[model samples]
Target: MTGGISRVSYSGMLLLGPGTLPLLALLALPLSWVQVGKLNGDVVVQCDTLEPHISWTLNGEQEPMAELVAEGQNLTILGLDLPATGNYSCWAGPVLLDTTYVVVSSTYEEEMDVTCQAESYHGSFHCSWPGPPSAVFRARLTHSDGSVGLWVPVAGGHGQFSVSLADPSFCPFGEELRPLRLHLEGLSDTSYLSLSRHFFLRDIVRPDPPQELTLRWQGEQLHLAWAPPASWQLPKSYFALLYHLQYELPNGTQVERFVEGVEETQVQVGAQRVRISCRDPYTPPAWSPWSPWQDLNAPQ
Candidate 1:
C-alpha cells in the first residue's frame, strides 16, 4: 500500500490510482490459478466496480510482469515466462481483493510409476503410486477383452486408490485367463506420468463358496443340485462356470465329476458321502472351500 499502490474508500465504493490494486487475504479469496505451456500463462482476478491498478507477487515476493491490463475491475497477469510462476496477490492500498497461484511449465511430463493387482475375485482390486502434492491421480481398468472403464473408487484417496467393477456386464472372468489391466495416471504441475499392470483374474478369483447344496435320491439314481455363488452379480449367460461335484464310495473310493452351468445335476449318486466345489472354467481358479458333505445309503 505504501511503495506499491494508492487507494480511497467511501460509501462502499473503492478508488485506486492507475498502478494501485486490491490485496484480498489468501484464505478469503477463492484460490484462482492458471496453467501455461511453452507459450505463456495468464491469471485474472476481478473485484468490485472502480478500475484497479495491480502488481503481482511470486510465492510471496514482488514479481514483475509484461502487461497489466484492465478488462473490468480486474488485474490480468499477461506474462509468458517461467519466472511468472508463483502465488500472486493484488493490493489496492492494503485492501486485499483476491489472490491466484500461477503455474508456468512446458506441460511436458513423465509417466508416474503405478502398480496394481487383484487382491480378491469379488471384482475389487487395489492400485498405488507415490506422487507429488502438485499431482492429480486417476485409475482405470483395462479388461482382457480390450474394454476400458474408469475404475470405481473403493478407499484410500490421494496416491493410493482401490477400484472395483460395479457393472455386472463387465464380467471379471472368461473362458480363458483374463488379463485384466490396471492403469494409474498422475498429472503434475509441470509433467505427467502413466503406469499400468496386468493380472490374470484366475490368479485372484476366489468366488464365495457354492451355495444351497442339496443331495437326494430319486428312486435308484442320486440327484444333486446347487445354485451359483450369491455374490456373483452377472446372469448365467454372461460368464462360464465349472463345478466340481464329488462323492466317496463305501469302500473309500473318491470319485469326482465336472459340470458346466448351474442346471440341476443328476448323477448315479451311489456313495458313502457326497460333496461339491466350483471354479471359473476359464481362470479355472482354485476350488472354493469345499461344500458340506452329505451321508446317505449306498446305491443297491
Candidate 2:
C-alpha cells in the first residue's frame, strides 16, 4: 500500500461485486529500489538495525517462512525464480525499516542475437542487438592492449539496442595482438541478462561503398573512376582498400573484376551498367554492400 499503485476502473456497474476489491488492490502495489540476484542463487536481504524482533513482508503479505531462512536482522531467500521476485519490506514492531524490489537475472534463447561492425580501422565501432521491449542496456570495450573501458549506455527503440565505442590507443597500421572484447548487460524491471563478443577491428571492418563513381570513353577503351569512401581512414598507403567492380555486357553477360592498389581502372567497352564495392585487404574477406548501379548513358 505504501508504494505506487496502478489505476484501475470498473465497468458502468459493479457486476463482480465488492468481494473482488481486495484482489485488485493486491495487484497494484508499487515497487521500490531494485536488488537483482542470479537465478537459482540465494539472496540475503538485511535490515539496517540489529532489532531482535524484526520481521519481513513481501508485496504487503507475510513472508513465506517455509521457503526462506530467517535469522537476526537478515532474511535469506533461496532458489530465486520469477515467483520470488517482489517488493520485500523489513519491519520492527510497527516501524518500517527498509524495502527492496528483488528480481532475478535471466536470459532467453534470443539473448545472443548481437552483431557488430566497423566502418574503418580507426578504433571506433558499433554493436547492436534485439531484446525485450522494456529492457535497457549498457556496453563496454576491452581493447587489444588489455585495457578495459567504462560502461557506455545504449540507445534504441522498437526492441533494438545499439552503442558506439572507441579505443583511443588503437592504431590503424599496427598489427593486432588480441581481439577486442565487447561486453553487454541488459536490464529490465524484473530481470537482467549479459552477453559478450570478441573480434579484431579489421575482421569487423565493412567499409562504405566506393563513391563518386564515373565512366568515360577514350576512343575504344572505357575507363572507370571512383573515390574511396569518405568514412575510410586517410593516408591511403597506410590503410589500403580493395575494390570489386561488377558490370553487365550487351549480351546480358555479367563480369566482375577486382581492382587493388588503385581507385581507377580500365574496363572492356560496351558494358551497359556498373557497380562497385570495397573491403580491407588485410582482414578476412568480407566486402561492403554493392554501390547503387550506374547506367553508362544515364548522365555524367
Candidate 3:
C-alpha cells in the first residue's frame, strides 16, 4: 500500500514541472518538410552561372519558365516534358548567359547526316534515320542548283553508294566532272539532301590501244604480211589489251570483230584487196579509221 501511494505522488510531481510537459509535446510534433530539385530527359546541358533565382526557358518563352529553388551546386531537370518541336534555351538572370538547342522528338520521321572523309573518291556520303524494323528507305539526290532527279528505293538502315561518269564525245579527255546522283523512294518519310563540295567521280587508268591488226590478200590468198605502227607505244601501261580486225566484203558491207588479250601489234589477213582498221580501247571502246586497202598483188 505504501509503495503504490509513493508511485502516484511521483507521477503527479513529474507532470507539475513546467519544462517537462512542453519538451515532451515538442518531441511529439512532426518534422518540417525538405524541398528537393531534379531534372529529366536525354538532352545534355552545361550551366554557366551559379546563383539564386535561376530560371528555365523553352523555345525562348518566359511564360513556361520555372525557378530553381533547391539548394545545391548541380541541379538536374528530369524527363523534360516539351511540346512537338522547340529550341530549348535555359537562362539565368536577364543576360541570357547559357543557351542550348533542342529539337522535339518527331513521330512521323527523323534524319541523320554524315560528312565523308577527303580520300573518298566520287564524293562519299551517308545518311540514317530511325524507323520500324525492316522498313524500306527512300532517298533523292539533288544538286546545289536545286535540280531534282529520280528517287531510288533501297533496303532500310545505313547504306553505301558509289558511281562514275564520263563525257559524251568519248575522247581521251583524261578527266571528267559531274556530281553523281543516287535517289531512293519508298521511305517512311520525305527526306531530301543536295550533296555539294563532295566527290562525284574519280580517275581511272586509261585503256590500252588496239593490237593484233592483220592484213591479207583476197585475190590469190598469198603473200600474207603484217607490221606494227611506228608511233604505237609498246609495253602498254594498262594491264590488259583490246584489239579488233576489219575487212570489206564484195558487197561493200564492212565486217568487224573484236578480240581480247591481243598483245601482238600486227597479224596477217587473207585475200587480194583488204582494208583493216585498229584503235585503242577507249573506256567505251571505239574503232579507229580504216587503214588504206593494201594491194596484195605485189610480188613477194
Name the top lDDT candidate: 2
Worst 10 residues of 3 by lDDT: 4-13
Which pairs clash in model 2? none
- The TM-score that candidate 2 achieves is 0.78
lDDT of 3 by residue, 1-300 (tens): 111111000111111111112335325532111111112333334445665556665445665443222223233333433331233344566756544332222233324332222111123334433443322344555542345644444334434332222222222223444544444322111111222233332322222223233443456543333443433434445323354555554555655555554433232333345554444544333344455765444344
TM-score of each predicted structure versus truth: 0.39, 0.78, 0.26
Q: How accurate locally, in lDDT, is each candidate?
A: 0.53, 0.74, 0.35
What tens digits encode model 1's per-residue C-alpha lDDT throughout 1-300?
A: 112111211112111112212335323433333323233545454454353565444455554554555554565656445454444566666565555444434323344444443423445554555555445445667765677875443334344444444223344443534567766544333333445676665565655567786666778777777787776546677655688878887679888888887646776655677777777776635666787887756444
Q: Order the candidates by TM-score, highest first — what do you get?
A: 2, 1, 3
Best by TM-score: 2
Clashes of each: 19, 0, 23
What lDDT tens digits, residue by residue, belong to model 2 across residues 1-300? Answer: 112211122112111112122335335533224566777777877777767788888766784532677788878788777667666778987898876656566656254678899999789988888886666677889988899998777888557889999988898878888999998866554565667888888788899999998888766678989999999998998778899999999999999999897988887777899999999897898888899998876323
- lDDT: which is higher, 2 or 3? 2
Candidate 3 Cα deviation (angstroms), residue 86:
4.7
Off by over 4 Å in 2: 1-38, 51-71, 91-96, 107-111, 298-300
